[model samples]
Target: MVFTLEQHDSSKYRRKARMISIAMAGQLVIFGMLFSMLLTSTFGNSLWFYALGIVLGLLATSALFAVLRERPWMAEMRYVWQLRQHLSQISGFLPTLRGAVEEDNRAALDIVTFYHAGVAQLATLNGRTPPEDAAWLAEAKYLAEKREALGLPARVERFDSQDLQAFKRS
Candidate 1:
């Protein structure tokens, strides 16, 4: 049973965050260079003054970036933003699948099956699912085993709360 839509890998989000950070760093470097140049021009031939200005600007910018990256809120915002993008892509399918599960529609069942199979493949690729995904893994494993035993292709079934709980208990 797939509980969530296919999300871009966490690595993708991390890379995006890193890219944003790099862009910000570039902006900081540009600001620092501009500030240093302005100070050098204002001081008019004082080498010490220009050197101090450059050092101060670099230090200030580094401190600012350190704070930005270390802030809990910044990290949370990045993660949330990435998740939102992922969900938006598949959000509509969720309700449709859920409704089908509720109504026992065959088409919906097929969709759900396909979705889980995709998720299972991802999980396998990732080496293991996250802790929150334990239940889904269990269900997938069970269905796969059952299908193999029966010599039939496996179909993903909707996992209700009861089904998840039963899987966990075993």
Candidate 2:
């Protein structure tokens, strides 16, 4: 699915994310205690049992986080999180994307446009603006022109997340 931009409260989102993270940490601690007791009762308090209980607690907490993260209250936080993840994923393969662009690969060009657009969207969402002459802005402009030269749109605001995988093949 393509992602669309929606304004959000950066401070509120950060606060909510921090609160959720703290809650998850508390869940882990409580589970750790409970698991430790249960395992001690069943396994005679061995040191290995304590370690295993912690591992189990971590798994449980992770599962709980996955479920909670899908709830409606997490919408803003989730969107920002997903955007951050998409940005991170592309960064790892950027050299590849740039390389493909050098070859005039249309798909690469589209992906790059999407990438820069995504960055700009995130920055705007976070209530910050880059200077006109910033390196990122200049680079984004250059890429947009390349896309425009090929009779394509200057920038893409919505694109499929799966398009990121194209870099892997590059």
Candidate 3:
């Protein structure tokens, strides 16, 4: 099976992005107010002190937003980015798995198991389906059954966040 980059719905992405930006702005404002209060308690309430709090708050918020943008839980954008990266690489690995399954190659079955589990895990996390998911599942199931028929263990390990992280590192 061939894999291709699919066009995502821009309207949905834009709506989510706007919501995240608003949340970040609200956090910044709250942080600034808290900082101002802290400054007021520590030192006398002065214009310069309040101004310094706002400046410091803005700097802190900027740094936090930069880091949060890359976090998977922040607005699902990072999840989509990671999913795209995985999908791009899958095309290259999939053909080998397909051949391995067809040839009943035991060594390659490990690769097939890992790839299938990883894709399944990513799809669940992203809340969306990859284009070839159905075909991939069918092939994976066939491979599992073939393994069983040959008196081999058919249990494929489920992939999780840690596995994904490890895969990314490699």
Candidate 4:
């Protein structure tokens, strides 16, 4: 998938995330309480019964929400979930990406560029510093400079996940 450079309003996304969180928390609590009451017959009013009921309820709600999140109302939540996954996958290949850079691999360069830009955007939205190593920060800075020095165009707005095929771990 290609990453877009559109600016996201943090408050808007935060509200969306809060709504989904509230829904899930409500489900967890409601299910937990109802199941705990119902399971008293099979397991009695013991800690084990309470524990088992809560676990089952949690499993049920988790599964339910996993499917529910696909609906249009959950767009913000889904986008955030996907963005985090992309960041993690990109991070896992940092070493290989850095190495690939020396070889002038365009795909690796694109992935790295997307990673830096995306994290910075996320950081802005979350009101925090971008979580990255000094080495990575230096590498990102150096890459931009070198690219500009060579008059190569920046491709920060769009990055394809398929480009990550080159960095798969054995």
Candidate 5:
């Protein structure tokens, strides 16, 4: 199944991307100010002090970026950004992917597999159904089996609240 770009809301993804960009910029500015102030107070108005302040400000910004990169929301933002990028190039990528699939290209198949996984993950996060959930699942299963056949240990896990309740009952 061909997944068109229109199925997902690009506006929402664009907003999330903007929010993350703004947040990162705000963090960098705040950290830079704090570091500059601390450095200025420690060493009066010397040239060396100014150089150290700049260095420290950069380090502070890097630290904040490192910390934020580990956050779940940041990860979600990254995924949204990736989805947006792919959607923008879908017109070209989709046809190439289809051609590759027809030619049995492993790399293309891998890309498709991960694309479906990402779509499913995005849908679940937004509490919506993917445009082709069943097709995605079928493709996922096929890829898992294919990987296993090639001596790769691939497993797919499905979670159901009712299944957990049944286990608890026993």
Candidate 6:
């Protein structure tokens, strides 16, 4: 089966985020275990030692939770969802493109625009169009090029999906 560029890009990104999250979880567990052992090792020496361990553990756990919430990996996962939604929109619109309906043509352009916007957002997160994103990027480019060749005006822009939280957009 042939995969579209958008699917290729988004799936690679989702896979990368999944790998990182798994690695981070593993590291957290290892660190917690090691720190617990070190903290409890001096249990008989002083009560303050145990107290320090509690404080340190609490601080570490809190920090870990905060990181997991705000890290780029979390954002990447959210992007994966958005990308999938955009893909579905495109797929749904594709069948109508051959018809002589203005509305359908507009709908198709809108779907392509959303797909490109997703690409831009993913690019911002990665600081570059990721190599994995190349496929989708190429597809978007090819489609846009085709639209241009047909004398159609197409414009696309990217915005942070998280910003739409005001209307519960996420």
Of candidate 1, the 10-residue stretch with the lowest lDDT total is 161-170
Clashing pairs in model 5, backbone N/Cα/C closer than 3 A? none
Q: TM-score rank, highest first?
A: 4, 2, 3, 5, 6, 1
lDDT of 3 by residue, 79-125 (tens): 45655565456546566656756777665565566566556555654
Q: Give lDDT tens digits, candidate 1, residues 1-170.
A: 23333344556545656786787777667766777788878877677766776676778778777677767646633444433443343334655554644565444444545556555444443456633467766755654564566565576433332232322322
Work out the TM-score per prediction.
Answer: 0.32, 0.75, 0.41, 0.84, 0.40, 0.34
Misplaced by over 4 Å in model 4 are 1-6, 41-43, 131-137
Q: Candidate 2 overall Cα lDDT vs. reference?
A: 0.79
C-alpha lDDT score of every prediction, in listed order:
0.54, 0.79, 0.64, 0.79, 0.57, 0.55
lDDT of 2 by residue, 61-85 (tens): 9998888888999998889888888
- Would you list the clashing residue pairs of candidate 2? none
Worst 10 residues of 6 by lDDT: 161-170
Query: TM-score for model 2?
Result: 0.75
Candidate RMSDs in Å, in order, are: 12.9, 3.4, 10.6, 2.5, 13.2, 10.9
lDDT for each residue of candidate 5 in 63-147, tens digit (9 for 90 to 100): 7777777787565565555554554443336556546655665555555555565566566556666766676567677777665
Residue range 1-170, candidate 4, lDDT tens digits: 77565566778888777777898899998898888888997667888888888998899899999899889877766666777788898898988997987787777777888888888877866667786788767977888975676576765777678788867852
> Model 4, 106: alpha-carbon shift in Å?
1.4
Q: Candidate 2: where are CA atoms >4 Å away?
A: 100-106, 120-137, 144-154, 162-170
- The better candidate by TM-score, 1 or 5, is 5
lDDT of the structure predicted as candidate 4: 0.79
What is the clash count of model 1? 0
Per-residue error at 16 for model 1, in Å? 2.8
Q: Which sequence of candidate numbers ranks them by lDDT, best first?
A: 2, 4, 3, 5, 6, 1
Give the per-residue Cα lDDT of candidate 4 at 46: 89
Candidate 3 vs candidate 5: the TM-score winner is 3
